[model samples]
Every structure is written in C-alpha cells, then in structure tokens.
Target chain A: MAALVTVLDLSLGPLTGDNFVIYRSGLRWLVSDGHVCRAGEPIAFCNIGLRSSDGEIRSTAPFLREQTDFQLTLAAPMPGTLHQLPDASRGGWLDQLDRYQHWSESFIPGSLDITGGAGNQSRWRLIFSAGERMTELAEDRSGRLTGWRRIRRAWHGERSDHGTLASLGTCEQNGVFLGEQHDFSELLAASPGSLHVIHVGDENLVPAAAVLSDRMRRDAGANALLAADMTQAVLGGPVTPGPADWHYAGSALSALTRCPLSERYDLLSRQGLSPSVAVNAVVLSVNAEPKVILRHRKLGYRAYWHRFRVDTTGQAIRNWLNVSFEALSRTIDDIQTDLRELCKLLAERGVKHVLIMNALSTSGGESIFTYAPFSQALGDELPSVRMKELNLMLHDLAEETDIAIVDVDSIAAGLGAAAHLPDGVHQSGPMQDEVRGEILHILEQRDFFAPPRA
Target chain B: MLLELSLPLINPHMAHARVDSILVRPDKKIAIGQAILELTVDLSDQFPHDCPPVSYYRLCASEAAWLRHLAIAAGEKAAVGTLLATFSKTSDEAVENCASRALRTTVVGVTRQWQPW
Candidate 1:
C-alpha cells in the first residue's frame, strides 16, 4: 500500500518526563505479556496510513520496529518489515549536528529510511527513515547501542507531547497536525505490520538531559549548586513539553516503586490516600509477594498499626515506624527495636525470614516533587520533619535488624533523570520502577524471595 | 478462594495493612493471565464506618477481558474494600478508581481543614 509513509521525529524534542513512565509501564506490560524488553528502550507504534492534510506527515509510523536488541517487537501475530541501519560514527547529544548542520555540511541529522524490499519498495520515511527494510536486518545487533560515544545528554523539556496530554493536543490531533508536517504517529505507523529495526549512527537519541540527570544523580544531586543548575534548566528551558519530547513516567514510576516507605508514601498518596490505598509494586520473588500494608495512627496518635500476612514460610518486606517524639538518637533506637519486633512477628507467623531496608531521598530531581498536583489545595499533610522521622526510623531499624535497607539514597543519587523527584517527600513515578528493580536485585542477592519450583 | 486461572490477581498495599498477592487456596497457581476470577467487594457493607483506614488488596484478572477479582483488605478500621474495580486491557484503572472512591467515600466523615503552610 504505497509503502506506508512514516516520520521519526529526531529533532531533540523536549521530554515530558513520560518516557520513563512509558518505559516502566511498557516494561511491566511486556513482562506481564511474556515479552523480553528492557527499560529506556525507544518504542515505535503503528498508525493506519491515513493522513489528515494529505501532505508529508503520514498518519502512521514510518519506521518499523526491527528485531533489535534495544527495540522490542511491537507487532502482534505476524512479523513486520524490518530494517537494519548502518552503525553510528559517534554516539552523542544532537548538539553535534549544530556543528554539522548549518555550521557544517557533515551534520547528518539522526534519521533513517525504510524500504519494504530491495529497490522495488517505496521509501517509508522521507526525513528520518528514508528507505525501507534492508537484508542486513539481522546483521546488526540491538544491544550494540553500547557503541555510541554518548556526548553529554541535553534535557529538552519542550518538544515532547507525551508530557502535555492534558496541556496540549490529543494523540489523534497530533497524528493529523504533526502528520501533515512531521507527525510522530506516522513514523510509528509507517511500516505496516512489521518489525523494523533502524540502527542509530554516531548520534544517540538518549536525551542529553537524561545524561546530565545521570551525572548529577551519581553526584548525590543534593549539592545546592546542582539543584540550582537544574532549576535554571527547568526555567532556562529544556524542550517545552511538546510533540518532540518523550515522557519518562514509566521509568520514574518503576524507580519509585522500589522506594522505601519513607519516600514512597507520597507517591502512594497520589491515588488520593483515602486511608485504604492500592499501589502496584513489582514483587521481587517469583511467587513471593511483598507485604504491602496500610498503616494508620491510633486514637490520640499513640501508635500506628500495619497488618500483612507472611506466606507460611515466606518472609516479606515491611516498613515499621517509631511513634515517639524523642530525640533522633533515642527514637532511632526505638525504631530499630520496632523493626526487629516486626521481623520477629513475621518469623513467628511462618514467614521464612524478613529483610529490613532503610530508605532516604536523594537530592537530585527532588525539587519537582515539591508541588502536589493531585492535592486540591495542595495536600501539605506530610512535611519534611515527618518524612525525616520516617527515614530515621528506617535507618534505626536497619541497624537493629539484618534486612539492611539498600542505599536507595545513593542509587537514587546516581540515577539522574529517573530520580528527578518533584519533592523531598516523594520521587517521580518513573523512579519508583527503577527502585523496584533495585530492590529485586537485593532480594535475588539474599535468595529471600526465590522463584518457586515451576 | 478456589477459582480458575484467567484473572489478574492485584494486591495493592497502602500504609501498614499490606497483602501483596492472593493465590487461590488449593492450587499454587500464580494467578496470571487467565488464572484470575472476578471479585466484587462491597465497602458499604464490609465496614460500619465510611472509608476504612487500611488500603491494600491482591488482584487477579481474566486474560482476554481484563475481568479480575480484587481481594482487597484494609486491616485498619479506617479503610475497607468499599468499591469494585472492573478489569480492562492496557490500562488498569478500575482498581485505582475503586480505591479512590473507597477513600473519598470514607474521607467525608473526618473534618479535614486545609492549612496552606
């Protein structure tokens, strides 16, 4: 059918922070669907070749998702047209092109073309994916993304539409408007019913902001200087959350999922903590589910209660709090004792064993967490002092018990973009997923929640 | 507790009262894809108080249709599984919606004044 046209927007679009969300959600969905995919993988979807303006922006995706290492197979039932582009000369942020573009002729914009077959197939992407699927599809590896030289990633907060679903246009309108000019929907749908894998040359599309985020994350991000710089970036302008941007909400959520109780409470409150809240956290063990419980303050705030079950011989993770207002030192001891008691309770309940871990907030990407969008008048119920107390309790408990809280603070500090927390109390959603994986790694190491016999 | 395997078992833990997953009583089947059954927990009748405190539950769903049973439990007196979550593919909003309703339903009783500070 006229080789379905597609346009892959390689124009350093700003990120809406939904990319991480998509990544986490996609990861879970793919895993749940029994598909093998990794986080941070760029996804391309299909659009029926219908166009609104009948111009360049085709209604569907142009480049097909090739069976590459980084990209997953999105087509159902049958395989789609595939393309394997040549290797990149340098892996870097698109700024390299400014030198090559108007400044230099060698600035080969990061784009590809897909042809269904040799010579006869029509070119799918006129700008990004210029041609069609080539025979070398299998020759290139998806994991080869490691080869890119990775220039500094620039955070383009603008340009991505993923972040502005409510703020901007709908996917359908974008499909038509951007399609008439350069619609991403067309690029996703260009290759009809096929797995098209396009190799990225020299230029890596992993967003510069993500790299900067990574660097700052590794640096503890708490340095006031870094926070100021980030604030400047947000104000000084990254890509305006537009069509060009990709939201990393998936990864953020994934990262946040692994947050220790001290930090995760805010995220859990997103669904409007009506006292009984439901949160989707990835379980570390195959058959073992973590003991996720709702804790509440007792009459006159004397104590709080959390109730969960241990699968006979299964030991699960739980967050225990210290109700005392004693000095951090004295309260710390009490928190530790409480954690030990809880673990002992689990042990007695036939829970094989328990692992206690403490959690702390990283400095990077936390400023964004300050505002509560869901809060009608800005739910200010949870304050820093309260949060600190929770952290202290977790730490104290860790000292007393064996289930050491993984240094989520350091790891989060190292995770630049994924850890971009909006507030000190809680992290962005994408980070939750990353934290979940990190905790899973911890679980695996201890052989705590081992996969039961299949 | 004993049912087929075509439902999605969802166990969401809020606060302290947490229950991660719910595997049918007899068979140790991991209630995934098609092993979950449809469940409806009535919050209005479950507890005398509105919005029982604890919020958490295990979810199991049907494969083709996202029809899953929600094994919601709020060990705390404040929260209970008051609303029912309908299952769907792609987006799993049913449970979250029900949970929100459950909370809002119960949150009305207490006098919560907003302090901007």
Candidate 2:
C-alpha cells in the first residue's frame, strides 16, 4: 500500500477589500504591544503637521492646529491583538522628510534622567556632551529634537532662559519633533495552522475567513488531513481571462502567507491583477497544501465600491442590472462550468475531499438609506435572491460531484442586514463567525479525526 | 540496549527533505536540545524563489550516548522518520553488531546502513 497523504488545501479566493489593511498617514501610536482592541476603538492619535499650499510647514503645535490640518484620532478597523511596529521600524511621511533633509552631523552620547516637579509634572532632562561643550534640555515629555546642529553652530553667542540660543531662532517649540507620523500595526495574533489559505473573492469574505480558518485549524488536530479551495462566485459580470496581471487580493494573500508562487501564471496574474489562465494551477501543484494564495481576476475590484460614479442615481444601476441580468446569468453558468471542471480535476488528482463555499450578496435592508442611490440600486435586484440561485446550483453540483457545499447565504441571512456593512456584501465580525462556524461544522462532519491511511 | 535516532516530522506538509549539513559528528557526545542536523526542505515549487525552506532540528535524546551511525549523508534526501543514526548505552560493541546487522537488511535491493529497532 502507498503512504497516506495527510495534506489539506484551504483556499480563500478573492474577497471584497475588507481584509486589506489600510495604512493611513500621520499617526502617533497610543496603544501598547499585545493590546487587544475592539473594532472602531481609537488605537492611535493623528499628529499631522499643518502644511500650507506652498508645502511649507504652517504650525509646529499639533494641538493648536485646525481639524482640517490634523486628524485627532486613528481607530482600529477590526478587533484583534495590536502588534505595534518597533520605533526603529517606523517609517512614514516624517521619516521621508528627515531623509530628504540630509542634515549630516556627528552626535555625542546623551543621557536621559527623569526629575519630579510640582503639579505632578515629571520633567525629562537630556544632557548631551560634545568635546568640551555640554548642553542640557528640559521637557515634560521626551521627543526627537530638531535644529540642534544649527543651534550648536550659534551656541557660543548667547544663553537664554530656555537654555539654548533663542536669538538663533531655535526655541523648544521649533525644536520639538513628533517621532513617527504613520506606521503599521498588525491586529491579528499568530494563528496556528499549516493549512494554506487561497482567497478568491473581492474583499468581503477573505479577512473573516482567514481569521476563522486559523482558529478552525487549531481546533482540529494540528496535523489533520484536509484540502479545500473556497472560490467566491462572480458577483456582477464575466471577466475575460487572459494577459497575466496582478490583483491586490492575490498579492495580499501571497504576502500574508509567504508562500512563493509555483507557476508563472499565478505570479503574473497576481502581480498584474489580470485574468488568470491557470486557476487550477494551485491544485495541480504537488505539496500545495497548507499554503494561502488569492485567486482574484477582476480588474479594479478592490476600489469598486469607492468608484460608483456611473450610477449616481438608483435608476442607472437598476437599469444596468436589469439589462445585464442575462449576461450575469450567462457568466454564472460559465463560473459553474469552470468550478465543475476544477472539482473534477481535483478529484482526479487523488484529493480525498473538496469543500465549496457558496457566494453571498448584500442584504439591502435599511442600511441603504445611508448611501441612498448606491444602496437603493443594490437593493433593487434583491442581490441575495440572485445569489441564492447560484447557491442552489452549487447544491446540485455537490449532489452530482464530490464537492460539498457550505451555505454561507443562509448563514448571512440569519444574521440579518446589520451584520453587514454599508456595502451589503462585506460582513462584520459576527457574520464572519457564522460563516466560519458553518465551515468548521462541515469539516467536523467529514471526519477530521479519521485514522491515517495504513 | 540500542537506541535509534530518526528524523522527526517537523512540518506536516513536509514529506521528505535533503540533509543540508550535519551539526554533530559520529562518535561525538550530544545532549538534549542540541542541534543535530540542518535539513533543507524544498518549497521552491510552492514558492518560486532562490531561498528554500530550511530548518534545523535538535536531538530529543532520552539518554547520553555516543553518536554511532550516519545512515544519511549531506545532500541525500530522506523520508520522515528514516533511521539516521543509533546509540548504545552499554558500549561501542553494540554499534559494531548493529552496523553488521544493518548491512544485511535491504530496502529495494539497496543495503541500509541503519535499522530502526
């Protein structure tokens, strides 16, 4: 008898842009490492410098600046552990400016001492000694000091109450520096799993599914045999497949997993965000399990929500959906055919099992009132109704083929409209949990604890 | 008593790996948690890159014993749990006896240098 294969392929195809981390500019971190935060909680404060139209620094004080010039706080987009980037690793707008300034100077060793003062104010005294010259600075909080080289050039001239040459136009306000304006912090903890995640949706499903998959794999034995590629059904139209391009969905997945691409098409398609010719390449590649890659092909899918100018009114979107319903239906059929072929190929490759997740559309509900026209148009066709048709198709395919269906729509509907954001398609944490629960349930039923092949 | 030291399944996805370099030498005394060898696992096909997935494993020895046999050499591919070496608590007498016995056992017509007891 041949050795038993114990590899599981977990794929999360394209998701709507929900899983992508948005790195904003001009942030001063307030959260500590390993701090758990809820979604929408303020994690950091923005201390963006005010710049004039001519690109000159307007004010040095961030607190005294106008709201237009400085955003007060930066909030966590999702709930998870906050892994703050180290201060040395921080690089952003301010770092760029510092690099551009190219001020070269040799700095002597500095010593920091904390001194307690009146009114519960503790002062930090930083003393610097260069050659025979000694400089002392006092501040309530310690931050990067600037213009020191220029002040050092004029230090012999005079002394002021601020301890520096005030006549040289160097004051504490002008010298004070805000360290890092913007930096990145990962929210999720390191999930324990060997299963690879291949994301294929726009942005809606991937983030939640990735988090859930990590948890699920941990619950199942560390070395259980399982393989699955959860491909998201086409939401709107049939995209022509050719000319390798890179998609953010795929690039993001690849970057997250750190698994190198096996085939050139996977690399080209992911890098260019173009239609992929080798959709089945991952399944075909040997030892492909426990790897995560995205299978997105739609162009401009990431920014689709923000670019809704074509249908300012609900009427245009409604007319477009109504008119293109046939094309959309045909595209669904093509997708179904492609999936069927993929399942057949996977089965032929000696894959013991395969699981397919049904696609989900937004529930228009009352949430549409927030973005009236776009929301109204999305609700017009009852997107869930159309998605249900695809779901049923998957069910029929499951009965006829080796594929098993995980009904994400029923799960999403049970959560109601509020479970989703304004986009209607993207889900919040609760909805993500429901979807993950269903997948875990399916895997459990499939006998995750079965003995390895003899 | 004779003890066999075999490769461990460091990664579930890994089937077989090439011995990059042996950190321990034959007849050298080793301790628990001491790195014994470095294995270069192929992840090139999965992730096309110049760098391969390389990992080092430490010996989980139950007792102090002289390193006796080297069934695998550097650049040689070995399956998970393949007998790499053996140790004896008593003396080197068992090592000579085990090596002679291993010479007779054949896998696919190739004589194996170390046998798992």
Candidate 3:
C-alpha cells in the first residue's frame, strides 16, 4: 500500500514591529531532515534582530535587554516529515547572525510531507524565545537558550492578548516548565492557547517569598544603596576578588535588583510588536521557602543560596557572605505571613492567579521506624516533618487568598514517588509530564485563556 | 554476628556518593535508629552543571551494635557496594570474617539550613 503524501508549505508568517525592520538568520534545524515530527513539536529556530528604519538606536528601545538573544523556534503545525529547501540555510555567520535576511510573510523555507493525511496549513506556528544574558561577554551559540541568562523566557500562540505565566520556582519547576531541552518543548506542545512562560534562575539567589516581595517593592534609593554596598564589599573586602568572583558578583547583583513580577514584555505576534503587561499567573515552589535565610547585618536585606552553589563561589564572595550576613530562623507562621504579603502585593498589581508548587513530602528509600533517637521537635529538625507543616500552611493560606496550590505532593504520591521522584526533589521524565499536565489544568480551571483584563 | 556497612543506592540517578559526615566513632555503641552517617549524592558528579541535582541523606542504624571498623571517611567518594564500615554484635568480637552480611540501615533524606561558607 502506498502512503498518502501531501506537501504542506512552511512559511514565515506576519512578524513585525513599528518603524523597525525585523531580520532573521538562516534556519537552525533542531531535528534532522526527514525526521517525523509530532504536532506542535519545535523543529527549527532562527535568531531574530530588530534594526531601526532610520538607523537610530537608543538604550530606551523596545526589547533592549532581550534584543541580543532574541529568537523564534518554529513548531510543526501538524504531524509530518520535515524537508527543508536546498537553499534554506547557509552555514556559519550567515546562519548565526540575524542581519542576513528580512522576515517575509510569504517566505517558505521548507515543506512538510504529511503522510496518510491532507492538511491545508502552510503558516508556521511561532515559539519566541528570548534570553537576557548575564554578561555580554558570555556568548554561547551552541544551542537554543544556551549561555548564561539572568532571565530566559518563551511564548507561543499568535494572539497578541496572551496570558503570561511566570515561573519563579526551583530546579524542580525548571524541568517541568523548560523540559529536558531547555526550549519549552513539552510546554509548547501541551499549551493550546496563547501562553507565555518566564523562568528566572535560582543559582545565585533563591526566589523565596521574602526575596520576591522585597524585589517587588524595592525603590531606586534602596537599589542604589544595595549596589553601592555590594561594590564596596567585593572591591574593598579583605580578600581580593578574582575574575570568577567578579562574574558572580555581577550576575548576583542583577538577580537581586530586578523584579520579575512587575516586568512588561515586548511580544512579537502575527500582528506586530504588542506590549504585554505583567504576568497573569505566577507559579512558585514550596521547596524554595527556606526555614532560615541570611539577612545582611548592615543593609537589612535577605538572601539565600543553595549550599552546593555557595561552595562553588570564589573566596572573596564567600568571605563577604560569611561576614556581612546573619542567619534568621523562620517559623511556619513566618513563612505563612511572607506568602500572604507576596499574594497581597501581586493582587495589587492586578494578578489574579498565584499557583504554588508544593514540595514532595515523601521519600521512596526512607523507612524511619522510630523517632526515639531523633530530636524532640521533629517539625523543626526533620525535613519531611517541616515540609508537611509547610504544605498544611499553604492549604490554610489558599483559603484566605486567591493562591492555588499545584499539589505536587498529592500528584507525586499518586504516581508512586519511589519510581518518579527518587530523591524527593528532582523528578523523572514521567513525573515532569504529569506535573506539566496539572499546571495546564489549573490554568484552564482559572480561565487563563479568556480575554486579557482591562 | 558481624555486620558490614556498604553504600546503598540512595538515588537512582547517582552512580557514586560522597561521605559528607560520619556521626559515629568506631569501638562505640550505636543505638538502633540513631543516625550514623551522612551522605550526599549529587547528580552533577555525573552531569556537571551550575545548578546540580544534589540531595542529602542520613543513614541510621537499624540494629544496635558495637562499631568495629571504619572503611571510609568524610569528603570521600564511594561507589555503590563499597564497604563504608563494620560492626559486631559484641564489642570484642573478631573483626576479620566473611560470613556476615551487610548492615541493616534506614536512609532518610535531610535538608541543611546552613551553607558551607
């Protein structure tokens, strides 16, 4: 029997900006040619750059922070085998730099041979990815979303009025949202409506409730004071900072000063460049809420870094951290209060949905038969006990606020934590898929796809 | 009866584990259910990156016994099935015997509130 074949032209659709020319580099194929692709699977991507029509560039230009690494990943509109045109791409700088060709709506670089079906779709569904590099010197063009980005984001759907979901969780959330490729493959395939996702790295500073709330409310004077104090500490400290230390200081300062919750986006859609307001939904992780955080003795700001990450820093920054910060313990009530304040501030910003991913409270390898030898205050000493307490507190907070728990505890438990979540933190592939489905379900329940609020 | 302490597979993704801290001293009586060893399994050891998949675990004694010999120390990396320590039912039992089996232990995942710095 002969397999039915239909050619579906993959054309560059309407990608525009006001008084600016949007140019794209040659196609960078994610998958090899003749590879069968699933529907909505990202197959190829290209670097996109914006240049002024009048040859005038300014610091206040739109997407100034993201213009350096702006890109668009093209997804397969339907299931088919991808076949690129012979002159589709010229390797080297011709494919690396975005100044080679202007974006034309009718430009067809490739065609999909749909097997056993006839489809009329010709326009490529765009998945836009942008990264704000930690430093301009850290240029890595190895793969999509590569290099050191202080903030990385991607969005899909052609509608200008898209609902944005900001991910401010730990690595657990990172795997679920960004997938194994770090290009949002699973999320893009699953999300049917207009959706935007932004992920902020937690390598330098964990985005706890205290840190996030502080970032949301910090002012210019406070930012100036923080920058000055950091500068003095790293430059004039007892130990001289090396290149590694300076790089860490710069990236850490950038993470500390920026407020992701209040960030606006310059979105490129089928119509043109549309300015998006703050995110419609924010997802956090209960795992990020530490029981103790470091507070600067003189500056009065809070900071927390993963133990492994702190060990990797240079001696100068380590010395600064050890001397300049004091440890403050937080009780369950304190965590609840911080979350409450964060939700209040977000609500004031007109955000209606706050989905928090609860921690996985069970371990497959654990078999604690007794607590006779353990500390008396189990909730304070044991990780599982404290997580249970925190999860309960989140349930209580949900009753009083618009916060919704993503309920990873229940989901992991239901899916068999031993096989899915081995160490109680990082999840397996099946586990991540389940978490992604639950997140999208929660968004659907909250009507996240409805028209944007005025 | 003599018992041995060998590294068990704590995390599925980890091929080797590091001895973060050993809480028990050899020749001392360790109570059942008491924490005896702290181990760390970092996936970054296998897949190196900035934000590694690191986890902490504590191994508690499942049977009361006299600690006999220690084979590993803190800051040492051991592969799975490597003997970590030895124990005996009595304090003065002969330490050289191959008739006994691995020690019974209960592994618990833990969290550290402070950083190494």
Who wins the lDDT comparison?
3
lDDT per residue (tens digit) for residues A115-233 in model 1: 23223222222111111112232232222122221110010111111100000111111221123222222323331211111211111111111121222233233333433432343
Better of 1 and 2 by TM-score: 2
Tell me the whole-model lDDT of each prediction, alpha carbons only: 0.25, 0.33, 0.83
Residue pairs whose backbone atoms clash in candidate 3: none
Per-residue CA lDDT of model 3 for A132-219, tens digit only, reads 8888998988778899888788887466767888889788888898898988878867875788888887876799998888888888
Highest TM-score: give the candidate number.
3
- How far in Å is the alpha carbon of A42 misplaced in model 2? 18
Candidates in order, TM-scores: namely 0.23, 0.27, 0.90
Instruction: Give TM-score values for chain A, per-prediction.
Output: 0.26, 0.31, 0.95
Better of 1 and 3 by lDDT: 3
Q: At residue A192, what lDDT does model 3 achieve?
A: 55
Residue-pair clashes per prediction, in order, are 166, 37, 0
List candidate 2 segments past 4 Å from native: A1-192, A200-335, A346-354, A359-385, A418-424, A440-454, B1-117
Write down the worst ten-residue block by lDDT for model 1 chain A: A161-170
